[model samples]
Target chain A: MFRYIVRRLLQGVLTFFGATFVVYCLMFAGGGDPIQALAGEKPVTAQQRAALTEQFHLDDNFFARYLYFLKDFFTGNLKSYTGRDVFENVGSALQLTGKIALIAIIFTIVVGVTLGIVAALRRGGIFDTSSLILTLVVIGIPSIVLAPLAQYLFGIQWKIFPVNYTFEKPFVSLILPGLVLGTLSLATAMRLTRASFFDNLRADYVRTATSKGLTRFRVVGVHVLRNSLIPIITFLGVELGNLMGGAIITEGVFNIPGIGGQLYKAIGLDDGPTVITFVSLLVVIYIVANLVVDLLYAVLDPRIRYE
Target chain B: MNEHLLEVDNLFIEFHTRDGVSKVINGVSYHLNAGETLAVLGESGSGKSVTAQAIMGILDMPPGKITRGRILYRGRDLLTMSKEERRKVRGEEIAMVFQDALSSLNPVFTVGNQISETLRKRKGMSKADAMKRAVELMDQVKIPGAKERVKDYPHQFSGGMRQRVMIAMSLAMDPKVLIADEPTTALDVTVQAQIMDLLAELRRDLNMAMILITHDLGVVADVADRIAVMYAGRIVEHADVHALYKNPAHPYTKGLLESIPRLDAKGTELATIKGLPPNLLRPPTGCAFHPRCKYAQDICVTTTPPLLDLGGGRTSACHFAKELLDGRI
Candidate 1:
């Protein structure tokens, strides 16, 4: 298992370089003067331009510039186009994003999996039909639409929640944004869970478990749930990276200071350091999530040993 | 015993499908006595397994409704009992080993975990104690290197070994009545005999009453004390194994016997029943076997024959059962 993890990490490093290189090439492909893009109609002196150019290595070749970007990231000297410290921005934003993402994951797994199991066990009943319709409506509405609506309805009209996120009560403040951010994924996970649970409930082994005089709880909880989770785990693992990336719209509406919002502005201003740093971290998240999912598959299914 | 160990009386179960209700088990009734092995012989969809499922209280309720009859275990009607009461009787008093061992055993769990889980839950043994007993049960089923193999999952075992694991799992509860639903159906020919022998030997050693459900006559011919032949969810014939094989009183039973290939009849076209088994959905009028039975007559088409007692513990569900017995049909 240790060897497997080490091998995967090595592969992850290669993937990291490959992904960032492609994104770097695409960002550079935007072309024209980098200083002008950053200045955005502001009057710039030749002296200031020369100083900034020298500082940011605007004259360097593509490979040299890429190396410098990597060096600046590792050495913690990376800065945004606005002269703000990219590392500090990314770090603090990541922490906030992480909190929301964690809450979103919890909301998705708990509500999604529970509704799925209940709906599957009582398939074709009222609850099942309603769950089907509910998930469908939620999945149909993207976070862009839901976030603002939820903010207005629950936050302002109902007064159930604060209109803006407050760090005083992080959990309380993040709950609404988390639910909004996880809406699509939660709906998706519910549908997948329902289908998987339905199929596994009808499996032959479930019958065997029943014949063995196991209680309903053990049968569904331990036996059926173990089998049902394979597909859910796969979906959630792949969605982990998207939770943060997809947080942009949620964070924007709720005024939650997170990397998603930072990444958005950086991309708009063609801020190389901030974009590269944030996106590289997302790449890392994807790699780790995939590895964890793969490892979890082995745990769930004995037939799939790492060896 | 005052009453049989397990008795399934006038049991009727139907499948409510979109295509309409399929009358699966049409008044099927049979019983098992202490230390007796009663083999239920039938083709697919004959409701042999469904009857066993109903007895075990594990039948899929909506699709499979037991509209009539009682499954009495030790003089108590299981159907009438409370869910909690019936659950106590299922694994503790009556256990079942299903066909397709690979699918029947939970895939993700170790063989030991699956076995010990039941021991822990029903028997209420500690994990360590239950696990040790699980290893013993594995060894009892003749699985080599039981202690080491107990940690292995179902997929790790070969077809025969997997079936053995399933048998071991069922035997763990020390159930008085072990209902093996086509246990060897998924195994190879050579392994089929081994599994049947292992089951028979275990039954004798444990002195447990067994209901061996099988399609192949050759598989149960030696192990079975009596054979109950099912046709379209009803028992067409029930008799001692020797008497039924020597002279079957029902045409369906006779047809099944002829289907079995004999060594002396080599190079000749293997005898097969001319037509297919009747479909339970919209089955033929009156006698279900009329379409498939060679001795089917006018009366056979108009009236379903009751399972007539032919004395000497023999019964046949054919209109001309006596004539067939007398060799006059």
Candidate 2:
């Protein structure tokens, strides 16, 4: 197990570097001049352009600029186009995003799995059919449409909660948007959980357990639930990665001051350094989340081995 | 006369399908005496396994319903028992070993845990006591290194060994009857013999009545005390093993016997039964097997044959049983 952990950590490092490299290539090499966009309609003289180019190190070759970014990234010297430290702002944003994702994931798993079990146990009944229909409806509606409507009903109409940004009570601010973002995911997880649970319930081992005179609860809890959890866990991990990347629109509407919000702002301003830093951070999160999922697979299923 | 351990009287089962409700077990009746091995032989979809599942109360609900039946164990009607009460009787008073050993046991759990859990539940044995008995049961079934190998999961065990584990699990509660449904079918020939031997030994040791459900005549010949040949959903013939093998009364039974390939006959195409068993959805009006029976006549196709006593503790369900007995097919 120790060896496996070490191997996984090493793989995690490699994946981080690969993600960083891809983001760096896409932001710098693939895109046209950021200075042109930054200058905008206001005409700039040759000296102004030259000074601005030198200031941002755009005068250097592509490889040189990439190496410079990588060095600064590791050294915590990444700066925004406005000359502010990128690490401090990006780090704070990441912390906020992390909290939201964590809370959403906890809510998704607990409620989703419970509802799934209830649906599976009472299959073909009113409760099962209703829950299945509700899940389909939620999954069909996009977060973009759901977020503003949620803000209008809960924030504007009821005035029960604040619609715009307020960091004083993070949990309160998070509840509406987080739930909106999490609804689709929760519905998806619940559907997957129900499917896997029913499949496992129909398995011969479940019948064997019943034939052993085990109570219905024990048969479901021990035999069916444990076997079904592997698929749900896998789906949760992938969905988490997706939620981290896909929270941009939801966060933008709520103004949660998270990495997703920061990425949206940087994209609007056409700030190359900020975009590169935030996109790289997103890539790192994706890679790390996938790595954690792979490790969890081995933990949940004994059949899987790192070696 | 031996006392009856289990008796099934006028048991009928119907399955609801897309087409319509089809009767699968049509007034099937049988009885097993204490310590006797009763073998029910039939082709696929002949309602043999359904009978076993119905007795266990594990049939899928909504679709499968026991329309009429009295499954009496020790003079108590199992059909009338509540779910909880039936559960108690299932693994403690009577247990079942399924046909596919490979699929029956959970692949994730250790063989010992599977057996011990049953022991713990049914016998009120502690974990430690159950574990000890698990090893003993594994040993009884002739599994090597019972102590060291008990921790291994089901997948690690071979097909025959897995079947042994299943048998061990069933016997853990010391049930009065063990219904083994094609226990040796998934195994190779040598492993089949070994499993049959182990079952025989366990039955003698526990003095438990067993119902060996199988399609192979040769398999039941050595283990079964009585044989019931089922055609469609009905038991067409039943007799003591010796008498049934010596002189099969029903035409279907005779055809089944003749189909078995014998080592004594060299370079000969085995006698094949003419047609498939009748579809249970819309079975023939009279005798279900008449379409496939060479001795079938106009009377056989027009009138149902009730099981009639043929003397000597035997019964046959055929329209022309008298003519067949008189050596006129």
Candidate 3:
């Protein structure tokens, strides 16, 4: 198991490098002049252009710039294109996004799995049908639509919560939009849990448990639920990564001072360095989340071994 | 004689499909005595497993229903019993071990926990006591290192070992009757022999009546006291094991016996039963097996034959039982 974990960790590191390299290539090779975007659309002389190129290290070849980026990225010396320290500006935003995403994931799993089990146990009944219909409706509506609706209902109409921009009280700001972002995931998790649990209910082991004269609760709980959670866990892990990447719209709607909001501001100002830094950070988080999921696979199922 | 431990008289089961309600087990009747083994033998999809499931009270309700039946155990009709009462009688009075041992045991649980849970629930034993008894049951089934290896999950054990775990679990409650449904079909030949031997020994030690359900005639030859050959959800032939093997009165039984590959017939083509069992949804108008019977006559196609007593407690459901007895067919 230790060997398996170490091997997975190494693979994760390699995967992170591959992802970062893609982001780096896209930023550099793609036809976009960061200097012009930062400086504006005004006409400039050749000497001024050369000076801006030198300042941003664009004068060097692709390989040299890549090497420098890699060295600084590893040494914690990341700097934005506007000459601001990237680590100080972007790092804290990444941390805040991580916390919100983590909380949303936890809430989604607990509530989603509970509703799923309830629906499955009462299959074809009112509770099951209602839960299924509700999930479908929630998943059909995009977060872009749900976020404004949430803000309108909870913030503007009811006046029960703050309207926007609550960095000082992050938890208060997190509620409305976090819930808006989490709704689709909660629905997805519930659907997955229901399908997996029902599949397990039809398995022969469950029948065997029943034949042993086990109570219905024990049969469903110990035999059916544990085996069913395998697929649900896998899907939840992927959903966690998606939530981390996709919370931008929700953050923008509520104006939360997280990576998502920062990303929006950077994109509006066309700040290429800040965009690359934040997106690369997200890629790293996604890769690490997947790594943790792989590790959990071995833990949840004894049949899976690292070696 | 200890009287009948279980009696099923005129049991009828039906399945509801998109087409209509189709009868599967049509008025099948049988009974089991205490401390005796009755082997129910048939081809696949002959409603053998469904009958077993009905008796265990585990049949899926919406699709499957006991349309008409009387399943009497200890003089109480189990069909009319409350759910709780039936559940209480299921593992405590009558336990079942299913086919496909690997799939039958819960994969996530330890063998010891699965066995001990039944013991604790039915026998009212504490955890430590149940574990001790579970180990003993494991030792009885010849699972090596029962004390230490009890914590192993189902996948950790081999097919034969998993079957042994299943047997140990069934025997945990000291049930009066044990039903093993094709228990050895998933095993290799050598392991099949070992499981059959272990079952025979356990049956003798526990002195419990057993219902051994299998399609293999050779398997039940040594273990079963009485053999009931089922065809198309009906018992076509019933007799003592020696009598049935020595002289099969029904055509389906004869075909089944001749189909078994034997070393004595080296270099000779094995006898094969022609055609499959009739689809229960639209079975033949008269006898279900007439379409597949070599000696099926006009009367066999137009009218169903009743199970007739041919003296000496033997019965055969065939139009030409006399012809078979007289070697006229």
Candidate 4:
């Protein structure tokens, strides 16, 4: 297990570098001059441009500049060409986004797994059919549409939660946006779980369990649901990474001061290092989530042994 | 009153399919007494398994339903019992070992846990005592080094070993009627023989009534006390094991006996029944086996044959049952 974790860490590091390289290339492929994007609507003064060029080594080859970026990135000395410290900015943003994402993940898992089990048990019945339709509707409505409606209904009309966010009361502010951010993944998780649980209901083990004279609770809960968890856990892991990456829209709608919001601001302001570092963090999140999932597979299923 | 341990009286089961209601087990009846093994023999789709599932009360409902049946256990009707009441009987009074042990045993659980769990639930034993008993049960089933292998999952065991684990689990509660549905079918020939031996030994030790569901004649020849030859959803013939083998009284049974390839018949072509089992959705108008029976006569195609007693506890569902028994076929 130690060796497996070490192997995964090495792979994650490699993937991080690859992701940073991709982000670097995409900044150039974005078709706007970095100097102009940094300068905003004002006409560029030659002196300012020269200073910026010399400071960032803009005349150097892509490989050389990438190596230079890697050095600064490793030493925790990343600063955007616009002069904002990348670590101080991205780190704080990540903390808030991470918290929201964590909440969303818990919400997704608890509600999704519960609903999934219910739907599977009451298969083809009213609850199953209605939950199916409900999930389809929930998944169909994008988070963009969902955020404002949640803000209005839960915030304005009902006064259940704050309309926007206040960092002082982080948990309270997370309620609405976290739910909006988690909606799609929640539905997806529920559907994946329902499908997996349904398949497991037909598995030979379930029949064997029932034949053992086990109560319905024991058979469905212990035998069927336990076996069905592998797929659901896998989905949760992937969904966590996706939630962290995809929180920008929800953050923007609700004015949550998270990594997503920071990324949004940095992109609008065209801060290259800030945007690159955040996206690279998202990639790292994905890799780490997958690593955790692989480890969890061994924990959930006795048959899976990582040598 | 006859003290039959497990008796199925005119059991009828049907599956509601896309086409229509397909009768799977049609008026099937049989009885098992304590310390006796009854083998329900049939080919695929011949309702052998459906009968087993019905007895266990594990048939998938909606699609499959017991339209008419009374499964009497110790003179009490199991079919009319409430779900909760039936559940208590299951794994305690009437346990079942299914085919494909690999799939039957939960992959996520250790074999020890699976067996011990039943002990804990049905016997109300404590965890430690249940676990210790699980090891003993494993040892009883002839699994070597049961102490060490108890922690292993189902996949860690071989097919034969897994089936043995299933047997150990089923026997954990000391069920009076143990139904092993094609328990040895998934195993290799040698392993099949070994499992049969183990089952027979265990049956004798516990004095439990056993129902061995199988298509293998060789398997039943050694283990079964009585044989019920099922073809298309109904038992075509029933007799004591020795008598059934010596003189099969139905054409279908005769055909089945002849189809077995004997070692002495080196060059002779094997005798096979002519047609497939009748489709239950639109079963043949007459005797279900008549289409495949070589000895089938004109009346056989027009009227379904009832199971008629031929004395000495023998029964055959054929118009020419007497003729066949008299060696006139």
- Candidate 1 TM-score versus the reference: 0.97
Question: RMSD for each model, in Å, please?
Answer: 1.7, 2.2, 2.7, 1.7
Q: How well is each residue in B220-288 modelled by candidate 4, as lDDT tens digits?
A: 898899999998899999999999999999888888889999999999999888878878999998898
Lowest-scoring 10 consecutive residues by lDDT in candidate 1 chain B?
B270-279
Candidate 2 Cα lDDT to native = 0.86
Interface root-mean-square deviation (Å) of every model: 0.7, 1.4, 1.3, 0.9
Q: Please identify which of the two predictions, 2 or 3, would achieve the higher TM-score against the true structure.
A: 2
Could you give the DockQ of candidate 3? 0.58
How displaced is residue A153 in candidate 3, in Å?
2.3
Worst 10 residues of 2 chain A by lDDT: A29-38
Better of 2 and 3 by DockQ: 2
Weakest 10 consecutive residues of candidate 2 chain B by summed lDDT? B320-329
Extract clashing residue pairs from model 3. Answer: none
Clashing pairs in 2: none
Tens-digit lDDT string for candidate 3 (A1-307): 6787688778877877787778778766666666676778787678988977787688789888878888777788877777788778776786667667777888788889899988887899999999999999998998888888889998999987777758677777776666677777899889888889988998998888888888888888888988998888988888888777747888888777688888787776656567777887887778778878887876777677677
List fnat per candidate, in order.
0.88, 0.59, 0.59, 0.88
Candidate 2 structure quality by residue, lDDT tens digits, B1-329: 45478999889999999898888999899998889999999989888999999888888877999999899999899999898899999888889999788689887678899999977766678999899999999999989999999998887889999999999998888899999989998989999999998898889888999999999998988888999888788999999999888878888888889999999997999999998878778889888888888877898888999998999778899988767767677
Docking class of 4: high
